[model samples]
Target: MEQSTAASRPWLLLLCLAVAATGGVLQARAQLDSKGFISVDCGLPGKASYVDGGTKLSYVSDAGFIDDTAGANQNISGQYIRPQLSRRYHDVRSFPDGTRNCYTLRSLVSGRKYLVRAAFLYGDYDGLGRLPVFDLHLGVNYWQTVNVSTPGFEVTAEAIVVVPDDFVQVCLVNTGAGTPFISALELRPLKMKFYPQVNLMQGLVLDVRLNLGPADLTDIVRYPEDPHDRVWIPWADPKEWMEISTTKQVDSEYDDFEVPTAVMQTAVTPLNASMKLEITWDPVPQPHDLSPGYFIIMHFSELQLLPSNALREFDININGVRLSEAIRLVYLGVGVIFNEKPYQDGNYNISIKATANSTLPPILNALELFSIMSMTNFGTDSRDVSAMTTIKTKYHVEKNWMGDPCAPKTMAWEKLMCSYDTGIPPRIRSVNLSSSGLNGDISPSFADLKALQHLDLSNNNLTGTILDTLSQLPLLKILDLSGNQLSGSIPSGILKRIQDGSLNLRYDNNSNLCTNANSCRPAKMKSKLPIYVGAPIVIIVVIVSVALTLFCLLRRKTPGLMKNSVKPQNETRNDGDTSLGLETRRFTYNEIERITNNLQQVLGKGGFGYVYDGFLEDGTQVAVKIRSESSNQGDKEFLAEVQILTRIHHKNLVSLIGFCKDGVHMALVYEFMSEGTLQDHIEETEMQDA
Candidate 1:
């Protein structure tokens, strides 16, 4: 919503007289305790926090709530920083870098109601001398468009919402007309019983909240006066109504709304007691809202003491339709009434008429009107959101990955395709992370997105074998793993799907990868001679074997010299042989099972196999990575790792103590790291800092 222009009515000049008579009644009030309130000065410098002198509300810098690289902080032009203006309007946090910048408000109770307000005062902070228009969003749904028409005037938007998650995100979206900026953000926890029309499917955006009695133009009712901090603007219409007030405080102890005593004590009645009290207004719909509806609430109280045999009662009417039979006003008592549903009419006229049996005129103290904001868009599915979050964190994919991944359609994360079905949350259909600078093993988090159809991880530095879980995706149609350093044989389930023409797979340029078991095995040589030459071939083979036997006997006598000549060939062989001589100790399969207590405790799992917690004979803790039978990693890869570990020495690298190469079992044993993985440690540090 844009800034509203106040009407230059003639009766506004007489408001000061009415407020002057009652000003003394508001003094000597207790200080308001600022609990459950989040007040932020958007661009305040440094990490300092302070209380505002005027409101006594605590304000803090927005550094911890927003990303450092998302925006820049600057002060407004000095000429506009008037003494009467709030300190928050002197500076702004302007987003000139991205289309969507968001501030995350955490530690909110889900399903609880809250009042969120965003204020903007464009004092030409950029020194451009031009007003900017932008859109604001509450999470993934559109709240309103902020069109700043005046340079020094402040425009504020407020909404009462039932937060759907533990936290809520307030986002400023650039509409290309100008850069988006914000001066301050505030949140106030509200009682759940208030605003009965507000629900999970809809929110109430404040259109107007006015105190209908004569008061000073600058005297806004909030904070210590109202307790709930609801901003109540002073309204006057002396042409047809006259103000009536009492110095006695209005009792609102039993009321849920608890309208401030200052507001309820002063009220307006018809100038002629015989005439009806009427109010008319025409609401302008927001740009994003075509058929806006309104929910209105009116507060009333009897300010004066009445004698016996005198009764004050009125009937409330809206647009010529009667809303109630009759409302009786009790002396020094307050009552609040609101519509159960929203009114969709463009024009509204409220008439309060005295009942036939009443001897007094009707009275009204306060009114609040709000436009219904539909929150039907459920945004992205939770499962897809969680999985995408994991993938983004794992790969550090920062290409506009903010807020809801697939929400609003126009601002979906880059390289992602989402499906939006009517009445259902959006689902991620495709993800392309090609050449995104991703490294290490392929994250298993991708498999958690059940609705995902196409995945492209090609042209990255990813290693490890393709996970077998990829073949389990029911809707998966395309899988691309090309142009990487991935090794090992493809999973059989994937191969079956490929052969049936159900899934299109890509794995080109990976030199070490093989298609199947037969393709991965070494090729055997065949003789070209016929059966007639078999006898001569056997005789020649025998003669060569006899010469080799004599040479072996001579080599045994010079074992030291033979060892140097044969060791290089044994190390370089690519065949699936387990006889490679290594410095690390080798254990039998039974010994491995004994050390691991029959593989009872699993440390973790990966593409190769599960890692088990084990202990050596000397009570040294170790992690044993046992290869699975269906694992794509073969004997060659195992032998290569063993040789590399023996040759390398680094303080950061885990020490390989031994290995297992018994029968068909293959395992690697290394010193256990007491701390968790590097990813866990980094996440913990970030959470603490945040």
Candidate 2:
């Protein structure tokens, strides 16, 4: 046995204890008692020694070899590493005279916290004769568990967690020059049982899979705990620690693994209340391992933790939209195999939220999700499509021409055009409809299409004065009106109003307009009444002027004009028994076509129809809508959209732009919202994608 040095080893032991504390809380009783220490001797030629518990002495052969002249700095006997006795050592080992020689070492230290005794020897080699030249190196032979903190040992243990101390060797390259090599090189700190209370339970699984057979255990990864020496189960295994079956791949899409089996057991168990559980799996088929890669899967089940609220739904703010939905739990699966070690090494994490139904109460029980093994080449298309479709179906709002609004691709609708350059969600652009035989007033609900840009409503049998509601549009630019029987003069001054603020407006056509001096302005003038007297005429004129000024001011400030101006669209369906027998109101296609001027009345087009700004014989301004046969829309989707639109009475939702049922020329009429769709504002970088 080598003599032990009694200095500088205790300081190193204390440093390693501080590192362990960062991992987590350690058992207070797991530390070593005082009077334990590790030391090396300078008097020995090639022996290294350690003392634990202050009495027991452990030593290793060829542990403290030193060489210095092997390199340009000095001689072969110049290198030596040994613990200091009161921080001093005089040990000497020498080489033959004038011969450059190299020295190597293999030593053992406490697995817990061993200190390294390092030194260099170079002066007066060869028994105080000629100087020798040799190379020196340091290497670890292999791994072996050692206990230095055992009770009744020789060394004096300190208050630190472990005794003796971990040790590492520093090498000086080309010490003597002649091609020196040290075999069995290893440089890792010894580990002891670090986490005693953390036990591997049933929920931690290894999903081994076979091609067409049952679960295979041969490929599963395993971790073993030693009973004698205090072992430290690593926080996680290295990337390439496990292997999976060659035949079957694993995945978590189905929320389960093909086969789950426990490969290792832990001595520590989770807490009874508020337990925070974690599971990690090491991967097989590492780059150093053989081909035909394998994978590891770990599943964790949180036993009985309760949420803060018993209510099913959680209100969350997503991309500026306030969404209230149930807090759902989703299964997570992590895969690692061979080159896929980083994933298994715990570098990246995955998060998934489960689905919650508003109508049902949440289940108060353990949450279980499986970790499965899947081939690296597996695709995500199937999962993504199904998931998105499920969300759309649950929402239940059908998109006109677009099928489900969340579809991967946009479908062509009547007057709708989609942006070709954008990704995923394409933008809606231009909508045009010059004329097609149609009837009905505009539905204000059309404004919900925030992506709309250009809207045209030229000609149709729509009746009613153009409502000021349209002035609220922020993006409207163009407006067209050429034909239609509208009679009231356009209120040009009132055209610029908005629901909450001012917006642009477009107006034309409707030849009966008398508000402005145009060719179509009425020539009729009220017959001059011979005022009873000049005095009375002057008085009447003054009173009229004052009243007109006051009215104009009041109109400008009317707070709820948009909300109050909206009228409910009246339509009736034919049902069997009418308590008071009444005739059904219907019209033929030809009659409607004549009203639209041989399908000449044309306005703007959108996802639904070609709008025609028109008027009834009574001179009511209205918008006639005609649905396009070319639209990819179906009846079910159309009706669903219509149902929602008609029921929504908000000032922001466009009203039923109106409709017609002339044979295949079916259309709806609406109160013309002079302001176009929101699409206009989105153009030229006016808005951002929220």
Candidate 3:
């Protein structure tokens, strides 16, 4: 084991020198692998893609990464579009629609560290000259609040995070203070070993990364200079301190942070060698009245060589607490000291004092201060997230349903209730899509929500029997499926639960639906004839029969003539009842061709036939599956499929709209499943796992 630096000064100096010497060889410039980088120019026009001249990083429009309909794109005012400003800042994506708008960055590696950055430049893009204030969230956790109070000045927020999943969502939440807008978003992958404090449950929100001394204050070091793209802002106080620098490169090979050579080459020390170096800062304000804890790292490197007898040693203290004692510096060698835990204090003061045995004052080359952000909110339960996502895709739900379904509580998806427990990921409990224009069957995804207790899918065009899977939900207490076109009896398990008073089931106004199997069956037709044949009775019967025959003849000859005739009670049967007792519509082959634009757009091909994209007269999207001549299925199989599909309804199953059986041409029309096929979903799952 290595001896503690405080116990052995000579050993500390030797270790520093040896590590620096090993890293003495200069690194050659090479092309950085930016495949993991995501640079988004929010509000960029059209499907634009370009490379940034300054950073040589590729940037693309955010249209593909976000819901384009949720926000409007606008360029910053002409005054702010100067050549000196980055092109990203010249445009902005303003969210004036929903309360929360998000950009999903996908194709990421889970458990990897990433530097997430959001940039905002309020160049009066709206022309109202009003600055905006809003909250930003990373996935389901609150990252920071963005306050754009100054014009022409760019505001940036950065955090070093360890992503828990393959994708991360950056959301802008409207706080009603003003409209939310974003200029640019960027993500850069970093080595896992960097920022040791960041983990699955804790992130480091950057307060500042400072380069202690530099000839030009305006010069910042990042990207090409620092492989991890850490921004180092030059900081100095010439009034009380002076700069010490060397042209020779400083070695930082053994350091996990990998500080840039340029940043470590220069440092600041007190102007008077006898005076101690001190840096103090007040606490930064945070959102939601949070009292944040902080972690800090300080770097040191000696620029000048001293005589063997002349030593340079110092003791480091933060907030009057000694963090390290008797730290020795080596010439042109790098050393880093950081706190293992966070300091929960309102103010901070770091003092570097010369030890009694030291011959020179202390020097600080660079420093990094970060507020520890607790990512304790583990987002929604993964199973529930998957189930809810499947439900959304199946129904094409148009709510503000982006990102995690239940997290950060305030931004949980609309119409969803979640249960949040301490130390446990949130679980979805209730979903209400009542009167939401849902046209298909009840989604089986709802059953996947084991914690679910309440579900409302009333007043829809849903047309299948209740699924038995719904009854398997252990916690389900209430279900509403009223005012639908559903047929067939309710599931027996659900009925039992309702009978036992453990569940409240509502299935009113479903014309063909029934509570019992017998009620669902068609009633038998019976006829009777009078046995008696008296003279008066026969004359009356003959006169009545003659009147009935004339009425039937008139109705058949001119249907429009009997405008006020009483109609039959079972009027719903008039909706194209087939010989097989199914109520599904029968379309002519010509009608199918017209709906599919003469089979123009092919969606996919299956064993049965090719699927074509089409739209009904009312603009409803549909997928027409035309049977090929070489298909193994015969007319009997097609008829059987049509009969079965017309009897079953499920939220996860594609809805059959109509069928065509004109001559040799045969096709089945179904509601378009915009989310794609089961094979696509399986492939996506496999890729994510990989």
Candidate 4:
């Protein structure tokens, strides 16, 4: 039956968005530094910036995203989740159906261009072992379908857009396939000239971003090193390709068409600079309504410290058309060019051959392709911004509330009313903080909003005064303050207004709140029949009896744990739990090495294996235990330890994060136990005895 179910499962159809990864193509020197850069380690919260030994560059946690909702902040746990990553990528925010999940970005310069990058890695973070497919959006526009086709691998989509107002909204919509989620996201400021032709059409949809000519295949280049923080994936010299590099410096004048110095430093030139690269790819099938043309870009810089007389000139050939001739790349200078062209029929790849050269062989530092689209700018309302800002602080809301409150009307912040207009920014008109677990006095500042007409602070723990200063609002009509701890007699002016039918009041369920004599009386209870009363008692007796019986059965089977005993020192586990939860991730042996930096950062040596302190991609601290090859502990002991750790959870107990069991190589991963061990604490308590 299980095999049948597995066989019936639908194989995921990859909805890979064909976006070409192209940085500022129009090239300018205007850049946003770390302070201006917005990095959102979505679904996770941590503040860390470090120089990654692998990338040889500094990467910081995404800085500006608010978790204003009550959604779960989850970390994905799966066999395929990659290792040696900052912990941030492991975090995700899941969205339920019927409501769209959105994140707003603020602290941005208006009318400035930005590179929006959204990353997703669904390593079954919920531990369901099932990958989900969903859609990712930019403002109210559809961006791409987020399909976790291969486990542990990352899928990313990017777009370049101008900041319409003071903010922008990145949202996730549930297409009814599964709960949508996001792992990490970032925004880089670009000059208006980044995509000069972008104004001629819609925004550019990213397809591929590739870095060429690296000795290492696993090499990845990212931030601090590349001030723009463009992620450059390295492509090493393949067997079919010949690689050459000169110890000469290379530079480019077009700062907006910037190519990373790291990539430009190395060049991929054919054995014969005259021979063209016959690159051919299949046509990317497009929907009937979408255009299939792509904008191709190649980056070049003068390589090889040479005399001024040496010149590298080549013509670019795409398909059968010769796009450029007499193109020269001067030493220590840069040149970047791109053109929009449709893919050749029956071929998905475009061939770029270097022919008709002037001096040197053809070489490329980097290349990218993007689908062009019209530019769009949409943001939130300026009015009523302060009221919500004050409300967020007063309630200790999550930082996920970064974008506009209602501009893109379809993706408004939860429980808020707005006056949305197509070309005009929306204005805050109402707020509903119902059943939100809010605790405090409803701020009088909220009463000052001139546009606010309806305010619902329902089912909260508000205290102090009733009908305090809220009556001053001129447009106020609807108010719901029920199910709270509000006290004091209703103000005479408010009561008269409520009685005169000038306002719609919902002030029920507040125990101490008094409006009239009948309203002051305690809530009446419904009486139960004798059979109902007796049934509950009988049910309770049966539940307690069954619980006690199970307790005895467990105690009998796990006698060693019930009564403490001095067991063998070599033993890894004691009898405790019959089963376990093991909510953390399980890693493979290969992943363990990456997470532990090949197990080089050792904290201490144990009887079973060495303990190494490690951090996730987002810089979260953890400890990994790699079983020793010669250890006497066997499979049974390892399983017992894992089971015991999973069964027990407490503040004082060390958490078993995950484990690895590959053939004979077994290991355990755990949360780092700080403040030393319990034994150390006891020993310090009896310092004189030592």
Q: Rank the candidates by TM-score, best first.
A: 3, 1, 4, 2
Per-residue error for 515 in candidate 3, Å, reads 8.1
Error of 3 at 566 (Å): 45
Tens digits of per-residue lDDT for model 1 on 68-146?
6678999999989999899988899999877898898888898999999999999989999889999999988889989
lDDT for each of the candidates?
A: 0.76, 0.31, 0.77, 0.61
TM-score to true structure, per model:
0.66, 0.21, 0.69, 0.55
A best-first ranking of the candidates according to their lDDT comes to 3, 1, 4, 2
**Two-way TM-score contest, 2 vs 4, winner:** 4
lDDT of 2 by residue, 1-690 (tens): 122232112111100111121223323222232222223433343344444232233322234333322222122233332332211223333323222222322344433432122333332322343332232211111111112221111221111112222223323222343222121111222223321111111011112211111133222221111111111112321241221121111122222221121211111112221221233233433222222222222222111122455222222221222222334322122121111121223222221222353322222111111222121111112232233334223333223321222212322334545444432334444444446433444434334334445556567554455544444444544434445444555544333231112322244455444333232334232111111111223454565466457545645786443233322223333231122222222234443443344444355676666765544433344555667888766543443333333433434434553333433555555544433343432331244554
lDDT of 4 by residue, 207-277 (tens): 77777787675777667556677778887556546665544334444445666666777768666656655
State, as a TM-score between 0 and 1, how close model 2 is to the true structure.
Answer: 0.21
Candidate maximizing lDDT: 3
Model 3: number of clashes? 0
Candidate 4 lDDT score relative to the true structure: 0.61
Better of 1 and 4 by lDDT: 1
Off by over 4 Å in 2: 1-400, 404-414, 417-429, 436-438, 449-453, 484-494, 497-690
